[model samples]
Structure formats: structure tokens, C-alpha cells
Target: MRLFAVLLLALLPSLGQAAFRCGTGLVDEGDWPVEVEERCGEPDYVAVYPEASLPGIGIVQTVEHWYYNPGPSSFIRRLVFRNGRLQSEDSLGYGFLPGAAGDCNPRVLNEGMSEFEVVRRCGEPLSKRVTWVASDAYSRYSERRSGLQGVYPVEEWMYEFGSNQFRRIVTFRDGRITDVESAGKPQ
Candidate 1:
């Protein structure tokens, strides 16, 4: 009984990460976006970008990032999609509960995190970009009142943690994290 109990405890983290799986193998890179959603259900967070016209392909591609918070013991999984297909996958390190204790770890910062929460966890960013959106250009959802429109605040905060490590850029709209994208390897 004790041996069985020990084995169960050891299996917990893998089990949590495997909570969502596809037939035969776990959902992985190259899996279609639809297959991922169907097997894993909805992700914890989603960041959609404006459509971009591919230079010569004449194809308009939609890119997106989906984040999943498995559990405390498991790392958050980030899935990148391009043109409705999974393009890449990354383990962004350990996950944590919302409003948890102070942590400078970037993995704790996630989409929908408020500006205050970000500062509280990771302190001020290396740089910041603020823009006043006069129209609904970046709005993901339509405004309820068509006539009531005015400039809204949008910001992008970049955190540089030095060379070869993952860097993060957090986007905020109305002071809340609308998207969190991983930048290229720190240089």
C-alpha cells in the first residue's frame, strides 16, 4: 500500500499535464488547431492577431497563441497557430494560481493579468510602449454601443531577462493584459 501511494504521488504531475490528450498520442506540435480544441477543450487563454497577407503566397494567414495552465506542478503550455494550424509548441515553465504570492518569474505572468498584477509580480519592464487607439482597430469584440466611441489606451510591455533565455512581451488594453507573446531568445 505504501509503495502504491508513493507511485501515485509521483505520477500526479504527468497526469495533470496529460489531462487533455488525443488518441494514441498526446496532442503535440503539428496537430491541427481543431484537433487540439476538440481534444483539450478550451484553453485558459487565447491571443489572436490581425490577419496578415503572405508576401507571395497571396494567402491571408491568421496567427494566434493559446495558453493552457495545467496545474501548480506542471508548466504552462503555449501553442502557436498559423492559418488555423498548429505551428509550434513550448513549455513556458511552471504554472501558478492567480493572485499568488510575489514572484518575479515570468511564467507566473499570463494573459488577462492586470497591469498592477504584472508590476507586483515582475516589477517594471525593461521598456514600455503606449498607444492611444482612436478606433476599434485592435478590438477583438464589437462594441455594444455603436455611437459611443473614443480613444482607448493600449500598451505593450517588454521584459528583457538577458541572453539566451526566453523574453516576454505583454500587451495591455484598458490596463489589462490582452496578450502575452514570447519574444525570440534573449540576445
Candidate 2:
């Protein structure tokens, strides 16, 4: 019995490995976007960004994040695709029902959460501004080594709760939240 228990523990992590199921089909990393779409159907939301450009090769690598919300009972799943192939999968917080407004509470916002998470919790922002900033020294060095220039996208999403509440500004860098600030109450 003890030996069996140990073996089961060893297999636990493997059982939780990243994979998404759709009806009878399962999608895994390295699969094509078409394969994932065929199995999982269209995603609830999709965000695409250019990751890097290699001038020498005349190649631009784009990254796409496809979000699936399988209702409130299941965790939301994000499928990441790089250069048209599935690269990784992530499980996020519980999903809400379709067509329902997100349960937005500014206090819950924090750094390091993905832009997808913010959208999932707050629905759409009233206004969004996008900018491109030069990559950090480390990222620039790495990209330069590969004959690529590093410029990353930065976005600011502003949300207004109500007349009685303060407006919030959320800043995202490289697809992740970097800062959140509370603006004065709406005029």
C-alpha cells in the first residue's frame, strides 16, 4: 500500500500537465492554431502582438494569446502561439458565464497579472492607449545577439467605475500588468 501510494504521488504532476480538451479531441503544445481551433472552437478573446523582428532573415515573430472561458465551473485557459504554432498553455482563475459583465473590483488589481486576466475580471476598459518602448538592456542584448531589435508594446487601460468611485489606470508592459494607479474621481 505504501509503495502504491508513492507511485501515485509521482504520477500526480504528470496528470496535471497542460492540455486542453474539446469534445473528444485534445490539444497540446506544438499543435497548429488551426488544430486548436478545430478542437476547441473559436476562443472567447484573442490578442496578438509582434514579439520580435529579425531583419537579417526578414522574419517577424508574432505571438497570439487565445483565451477560453469554460463557464464559471472551470478555470480559464490561455493558449499561446508563437510564429503560428502553439507554444504553451496556462490555466487562470475561474471563468464567468458568457455575456455577463465581469466582476470588476479595482482593489483586486495587482502587478504581474496578465492583460488577459484584467480583461477577464473587468470586461473592456473605457479607453485604451498603446505605445511602444525600447526593450530593457537584458532583452536588447539577447535580441541583438540574434540579429533582432527589441521594441516591446506598452498599453494603458483606463476604467471608470462610477461617479462615486475613482477612475483607475492600468499599465501593461510586454502583455503583463506592471503598474496600477487610482486617478481622482470622475468629474
Q: What is the lDDT of candidate 2?
A: 0.78
lDDT of 1 by residue, 1-187 (tens): 9999999999987775533453344675567887888777787767665333323453244557787767679877667776677766666657767556766766777776655557647877988876645446653232332222344446798986668667898988644588888888765
lDDT of each: 0.65, 0.78
Model 2 per-residue lDDT tens digits across residues 62-141:
77889888988998888889888887888877887887865688886889877777887788888988665565764576
Clashes of 2: 0
TM-score of each: 0.42, 0.74
The alpha-carbon RMSD values of the candidates against the true structure, listed in the order shown, are: 14.8, 4.1
Error of 2 at 103 (Å): 2.5
How does residue 24 of candidate 2 score in lDDT? Answer: 78
* Predicted model with the maximum TM-score: 2
